[model samples]
Target: MRLDKFLKVSRLIKRRTLAKEVSDAGRVTINGRVAKPSSEVKVGDILEIGFGAKMLRAEILELKETVKAEEAKNLYRIVE
Candidate 1:
């Protein structure tokens, strides 16, 4: 899945556009490197997102085109 779509589908970011914008602005990183909106997302990949004063890090658990709200949390694992 695309990074932006993965972010939205996984409920990490609220919207795909916002995710793309932030990613393009260099706020999103994959394996500690800046990632683009079109970056490919795969299982076990580490993702880090910078949001103002907050930073979110997660490990991709699964990649699905669509997911229910209840199942969204199953897509990734949070990492401190």
Candidate 2:
């Protein structure tokens, strides 16, 4: 799955376009390297997102094309 799509489906960013914009602006990284919105996301990959004064990190667990709201959290594991 694409990084941006994964973010939206995972409910990390809420919207695909916002995720893409943030990614394009270099506010997101994969495995500690800057990643584009089109970047491929696979299971076990680490993602870090900078949200100005705050940051978020997560480990990809599953990558499905679509998931229910109740199942969204199952897609990734929050990392401290």
Candidate 3:
């Protein structure tokens, strides 16, 4: 899955466009390197997203084309 799509499908970001913008602006990273919207996302990959005044890090647990809101949380696991 693409970084932007995963972010949206996983409910980490509110929308796909927002996720793309965030990724393009270097606010998103994969494995400690800056990432783009088109970056590939796979199981076990580490993702770090920067939001104003805060940062979110998560590990991809699964990749799905679509997921319900209630099940979105199952797609990734938070990392400290």
Candidate 4:
């Protein structure tokens, strides 16, 4: 799945457009390297997102086109 879509589908950023904007601004990384909005995301990939002064990191556990709000949390696992 595309990084932006994955972010939204997983409820990480809440919206696909916002995720794309954030990714385009270089505030997101995959496997430690900066990634673009269209970047591909796969299972097991590490994602680090910068949110103001805070940061969120997670590992992709699964990729789905759509997921229930209650099940979105199952798509990725938080990482330190």
Candidate 5:
């Protein structure tokens, strides 16, 4: 799955466009390296996102084209 798509489908960013903008601005990383909006994402990959002074890290557990709001959390697990 695409990084931006995963972000939205997983309800991490709420929207795909925002995810793209965030990613394009170098506010997102995969495995510690900066990532792009079109970056390919796979299961077990570590995703880190910067929201101003806040940082979010999540480990991808599953990939899906669409998921319900209640099930979004199952796609990734938050990491400290």
Candidate 6:
């Protein structure tokens, strides 16, 4: 899945556009390297997102085109 779509579907950023903007600004990384909004996201990939002064890291656990709000959290697992 596309990074932006994955972020939204996983409820990480709430919206696809916002996720795209964040990724475009270089505030997101995949496997420790800067990633673009159109970057491909696959299972087991590590994603680090910067939100203001805070940072969130997660490992992709699965990929889906759409998921219920209650199940979104299953798409990724938080990492330290």
Off by over 4 Å in 6: none
Counting clashing residue pairs in each candidate, in order, gives: 0, 0, 0, 0, 0, 0
lDDT of 4: 0.97
**How displaced is residue 62 in candidate 5, in Å?**
0.4
Ten residues in sequence with the least summed lDDT for candidate 1: 11-20
TM-score, candidate 4, is: 0.98
lDDT of 1: 0.96
**Candidate 1 residue lDDT tens string, 11-62:** 9998999999999999999999999999998999999999998999999999
**lDDT by residue for model 4 over 1-80, one digit each (tens)?**
89999999999999999999999999999999999999999999999999999999999999999999999999999998
For model 6, residues 1-80, the per-residue Cα lDDT tens digits are: 89999999999999999999999999999999999999999999999999999999999999999999999999999998
Q: Over the full model, what C-alpha lDDT does candidate 3 score relative to the true structure?
A: 0.95
List clashing residue pairs in candidate 3.
none
TM-score of each: 0.97, 0.97, 0.97, 0.98, 0.98, 0.98
Instruction: Please list the residue runs of candidate 3 whose C-alpha ends up more than 4 Å from where it truly belongs after superposition.
Output: none
User: Residue by residue across 13-42, what tens digits does model 5's lDDT show?
Assistant: 998999999999999999999999999999
lDDT of the candidates, in the order given: 0.96, 0.95, 0.95, 0.97, 0.96, 0.97
Root-mean-square deviation of every model: 0.6, 0.6, 0.5, 0.5, 0.5, 0.4
Off by over 4 Å in 4: none
lDDT of candidate 3 over 1-80, digit per residue (tens): 89999999999999999999999999999999999999998999999999998999999999999989999999999999
> lDDT per residue, candidate 2, 1-80, as tens digits?
89999999999999999999999999999999999999998999999999998999999999999999999999999899
Candidate 4 clashes between residue pairs 3 or more apart in a chain or in different chains: none
Report the lDDT of model 5 for residue 3.
Answer: 98
Q: How displaced is residue 55 in candidate 1, in Å?
A: 0.9
